[model samples]
Target: MVFVVFIVAAIITFAAATKLSTYADALSRLSGLGSLLIGTFLLAVATALPEVTTTVTAVFLDNPDMAVGNILGSNHFNLLILAVFDIIYRKRKMLAHIYKQQRYTALFGVFMTLVIALAIFMRLDIPILTIGIDALIIVALYLLSLWIIQRTPVPEQEKNHSSQEEEYSLKHALMGFIIMAIIIFISGTALTLSGDQIALITGLGSSFVGSFLIAGSTSLPEVVTVLTAMRLNNENLAAASIYGSNLFNMLLLVVCDLIYRGPILQSISLSHAVTAIFLLINSSLVCYAMFARKNRRFYTWPSLVMILFYILTMVWLYYSS
Candidate 1:
């Protein structure tokens, strides 16, 4: 029964995520928002719905470690999705096309890494106030991205776009958004329950189940979307979505902590340390690939390197834990 629930939830999660991405793209076009702003804010928030719902549910169930582990684990898995996207774009070398805009994605990736590192390494007491601060940071960064986009000059081709092409029907998009949100909420809850049952049956910890299984399962949506986007020649959207999702995950942690009330740091596990190390290494590689313009543009080698590193890290974590 538990295994069945896990499978069902995974299916729902994938469907919901696809719908959410479609709606997000439409809404962005309607709102006249640049990819950077829409990707970082609206799309980011939508993709992270599962994380938010699952973590909140775990916290309410008094499984704080599971909640934190899910976020950390999801972040680690999200980085792996970048490699997955690269693999899908093998022939075209997706990164080659975005040599100019890669810097923005790299910067966002670095910022997300710093935020996660601070959460993991800093020994400061996790107060509710910290959540408010984190929320402010997220909002500020999103607004800043929008400002930058607005101030930047648009290319001549973009300036001549028709009004009909830019505007999306809001009623249809909103309906789709709501439907996706319901699916994500329901599926995430089912997955959380399944995780708890598996932990109980196997005598494994909830954090262990949430981190390795649940986190990886739930992140499939982001992985599939990125790979699909890459295949469709939407390299910019793929990169934006990946980075956007990371920022959303990090910010959601703050919200989860605040809502759960008091000292979240106390519940954080050593698994977070391993996850953080992997994130730092993966993010550094991304930044390097983006900035190292003189090097060969092909991401085949870098993608392989990331996959190997992720696998090794997982192996080490499993044995060590």
Candidate 2:
């Protein structure tokens, strides 16, 4: 029964997510908002909203580790999606086509991840008001990343999308996108509950469920959105969606911290820091892909290494937990 609910909720959420990329593209065209900004901020907020809901719920349930695990685990999974992009467009690397702003976004991910890892070890999450001081720092950095991304210049081709013949008027696109986003949020909540129940019945530990199963459940929308964007040949939107979602998930930790009574980071098992390490490693791999600009005939070492490390990290986390 739990599995059944998981499948139904996932299908519903993913179906809406598929259209999410389309509506987002239409919104970009009709409104002339660059795909970079739309994907990074707008589409990003849409896809990552589920994490906000689920993480806070986890904290309220006295599962702060699960909440942290979901954020860091989703961060790793989002980067894994980036590696998939590399394989999808192998002849010409995925990084080759995207705007330079992505490097900044990727760097922001790395910096934030480092903060998370260090916070766990240092226990710097001193309670300031309701939230921790560390959480406050993360919130501030996320805002700065947004401001910088907003100011970055988009390519003329992306800027000129408004000139193309459009299917959705700005009004219709806005309505459709809002409606789909609401569906995603509702179904995603269902998915999270069902997934948690399944994990319980199967006796998968909370950390495992949070890092692997629950994180995957929450990321289903991102998967569908990125795949649809690929089919549309919208590389910029596709890449930005993953990077943007990654960034949003990091910021989400601050929210989770706020909801918990104590410092959320200090309360969770240090096992979660294992997940954070994988995030830092994988995010650095992404930056390397962007900065190195090396392309092979079929695949690159960084992409391959990312997948390998991800699998290894999951196994390590399982045993450690």
Candidate 3:
């Protein structure tokens, strides 16, 4: 029964997520929002809706480990999606043409992940009027990231998407995006509950299950969105989505802290720091790949290395847990 619920949730989430990318693209074009900004802010938020829902649900369920793990694990998974992008993008080096705007976004992810690692290790007892200092810092940084991404100059081609031919109107696109988001919210909630139950049934730590299974499930939207963006030949959007999703994933810690009964960061297992480390490394790899401008036969060396590291990290986390 638990397995059935999980599979069903995954299917529904994927179906909704496929629609999510399409409407998000339409919204970008109709609104005249550059793919960089839309991919980072709007599309990133839309694709990350599942993570937001799942994290909040985990917190309300009193599963801090699951909440934290899901976000960090999803962060890693988002970057892993890039590796897939590189393989499929056979024309040119995938990361070579990624917009310069994403440089700041990637760096911001590193900064936020570092903050999370610090919070986990420090576990500060100090709270400002009931809110942990770390939570406040994370929220502040996330807002700053948003500002930076918004202000960055978008290339002319990206800015002129509004002039391009699109299939949906602004109103219809908004409506479709909202409907898909609602479906994702419902499916993600179901995934969270079943994931929690599965953790218990398997006698595995929430950190393990949340980091691997739950994280992968919640990240379905991102994977679909990234692939869809690539198919459209908007590699910048695909790249930005991954970077922006990582930033959004970190921001979700604030949401988790707010809904959780206690200091969410302090309550999470230190094992999650391992996951954070992987996220930081993968995010940094993105920066390196973008600047290195190297291309390979199938995929770049960084892509392969990052994927290997992720698999190894998952293996280690599984046995360690």
Candidate 4:
């Protein structure tokens, strides 16, 4: 019965998220916003609504480890999106170019992952008014990262949206984005709740379930969004949406910390450090891939390593959990 509910909720979430991607692309065309900004702020947050809903709900249910696992797991899962794209489009000239902002965004992701890992390892958390200072730093760093990315100038060649479709009103696009976001939020809640119940029934442990299962469930929208952006030749949109959501997932720690009634980072299993370490490694590899001249060859070695590493990390975590 729980499996049935998971399937239904996943379908609804995926369907809404697919529509959400289209609306986000429409906004990119109609708003005159830079593609990265639109992808990072709008589409990234839209796709991240599941993490927001799932993580917060986990904390509300007094499952801090589950909440934290969802964020860390989602960040790593988001990085894996880049690997999947690289493999699928390999040997094609598509997505052969790299953007400076993407490199910066990925670098920021690496740094943020490092911070979380170190915080988890050291556990020297000081709480101010029940909120950990580490949480504050994570949120502050995320905001700074956003500011830097926003100021980074867009390449003139990538600025124009060249679709020949009939004009889409910004009003209609905004409405669709909002409606889809709401549906995704509600359905995501169901997805996570079912995932939690499944974790209980299957005895997989919330660490495994939240990080692997629920995290993957919530990230389904990103798969659709990235595919649509690549289909449109908007590589920046795809890349930004992936790395941007990773950064947002890091910020989710603070949300969990605020809701969990304690220093959320210190309360979770140290096993999450496994996730943090792996996340740092994956993000760093992505950063290297963005700058490596080999990236121009259209056959990416780093992506291959990343794909394998993601699988290895998940296997390692499942057993450890």
- lDDT top scorer: 3
Tens digit of per-residue lDDT, candidate 1, span 1-321: 789988989898887777676666666555555444555556666666778777788888888777877776787787788777777756666655553544665676566566556656665453445553434555566556546544654333322332545344878887887788677767888888788677778766665666777788778678766755555455655676777777667666666667776656455676666667777788877777666643665557776787887787666556544
What would the per-residue lDDT of candidate 4 be over residues 1-321, giving only the tens digit for each residue?
Answer: 999999898888788887777777777767767677888888898899989989988988888878988998888788788788878876542335756677777888888888889999999578986788777777878888888877877677655544447345789889988999898889888988888899899998889888999999899889888888788677778888998899888888877777777788888898898888888888888877777745455457778888788888789778977
| Candidate 3 per-residue C-alpha lDDT over 212-294 given as tens digits, one digit per residue, 9 for 90 to 100 | 99999989988888888777777877887888888888888887777777789899888887777777788788788776665
Highest-TM-score candidate: 2
Model 4: worst 10 consecutive residues (lDDT sum): 158-167
**TM-score for each prediction?**
0.84, 0.95, 0.94, 0.94
- The lDDT of each candidate is 0.67, 0.81, 0.83, 0.82
TM-score of 2: 0.95
Q: After superposition, how far is residue 172 of candidate 4 from its true place, in Å?
A: 1.5
**TM-score, cand. 1:** 0.84
Sorted by lDDT (best first), the order is 3, 4, 2, 1
- Per-residue lDDT of 1-321 in model 2, one digit per residue for the tens? 889888888788778887898999887777766888999989988988678777877777787767888888887888787787678677667776677778888898898899999999898846777887778888888899989987887678776666777887889989999999998888867766776676678777778888887787788878888888888878788888888898888888777776667778888888887778877898898888887765544346788889888898789778876
Alpha-carbon deviation at 109 in model 1, angstroms: 3.1
Candidate 1 stretches with Cα past 4 Å from truth are: 99-102, 126-170
Which pairs in model 2 have colliding backbones? Answer: none
